[model samples]
Target chain A: AQSVAQPEDQVNVAEGNPLTVKCTYSVSGNPYLFWYVQYPNRGLQFLLKYITGDNLVKGSYGFEAEFNKSQTSFHLKKPSALVSDSALYFCAPPSNDYKLSFGAGTTVTVRA
Target chain B: EADIYQTPRYLVIGTGKKITLECSQTMGHDKMYWYQQDPGMELHLIHYSYGVNSTEKGDLSSESTVSRIRTEHFPLTLESARPSHTSQYLCASSEVYSSGGAETQYFGPGTRLLVL
Candidate 1:
């Protein structure tokens, strides 16, 4: 069984500042990791994924994630935050059988 | 536009009432899934279908039942609604890759249900 953890419940950052949302995972085999974002009252939208080869993956809305094997972490990062970037983010690990095990989610609030 | 749609964006019903949540995709994807989520919580997959008539239960134990009668439709039904079942239901669909590897899922707008 695979599991994911997002240590932060909420991350607040000033607009134009760099931001990071932490995520870690435990899986049996090679891991397939994903990042998703949800706006208020909406379903999750895929942001990025790390399947293999690349350690740093870039995604939509100028978001990126770094996959660190040694730390067992895949933290989401953005060079500069925007107020429009405020949303709930989730990190997920792929199940052996193609399902996804999601983290508890982290809400990002970009203050102006 | 290719899209996945979930009907009854907001539903409020009494406990013990039977209800069905409708989901459909026009993307011609062969895989469909249903997930339950509470506000500010993780998503739990309740059911999934690989294709028409191939529904399967997911990791989470759910009281709801689902069916895939058509390639584009997957509907979830609850025989008896309860307060515990009050949550946002998300519908998603994905195209299966021949390589037997990872695939990205496209999600609908989601349906919010409240059981009174």
Candidate 2:
């Protein structure tokens, strides 16, 4: 079964500081990874995805992720954290055969 | 801009009530999916459709049923609502490009349901 794992439940960072949210996955074949953010009372907004080619993928809101094949990890990163960036983040792995499997999620708190 | 829309942005209903959540997309995507999510929690796929008149259950077991009568419309119905069904339901659509799973999904605002 294809699954995704987000190790941290929450990550706290000060405004203007760099931030990182870790993610790993287990799949039988090629993996299709994605990052999504959900604001309060809203649906998830797609941030980025890694299908093939580039190992380092850039996304919306100045977010980026690095796909490591050997470690099976695709961690999201940002050069500088902003207060507006505080939200719930989810890492998902596409099953293609059925649906996408999401991680438990990680809450990012950007304190100003 | 092209988008997916879900109706009844917020709903609080009593148990045993039959309710249908409507989902429509204008992106002309062939695949659509329904997901259930609790507050500040992970998203679990409840159902999905490949195209019109095609539907399949997802990883999560759900009492709600869905139908895809039109290419751009997929509606989910709950025969009898329960307290456990109180959660946010998200509707998404994607255009499957190749068999390698390179499709990107576009989501709607979602419907928040509260079964009292």
lDDT tens readout by residue for model 1, A3-75: 7888889999999999999999887777888899998888889999988888999999999999999999999
Clashes of each: 0, 0
Q: Candidate 2 - CAPRI tier?
A: medium
**Model 2 misplacement above 4 A:** A96-98
Candidate 2 chain A weakest ten by summed lDDT: A94-103
TM-score of candidate 1 chain A against the true chain A:
0.95
lDDT of 1 by residue, B20-93 (tens): 99999998999999999998788889999999889999878999999998999999999999999999999999
Report, for every candidate in turn, its global Cα lDDT versus the true structure: 0.90, 0.90
lDDT of model number 1: 0.90
lDDT of 2 at B94: 91
Q: Give the per-residue lDDT digits (tens) of candidate 2, residues A1-112.
A: 5778899999999999999999999988888898989888888888999988999999999999999999999999999999999999999877757466776799999999
- Alpha-carbon TM-score of each model against the true structure: 0.93, 0.94
Tell me the lDDT of model 2 at A87.
95
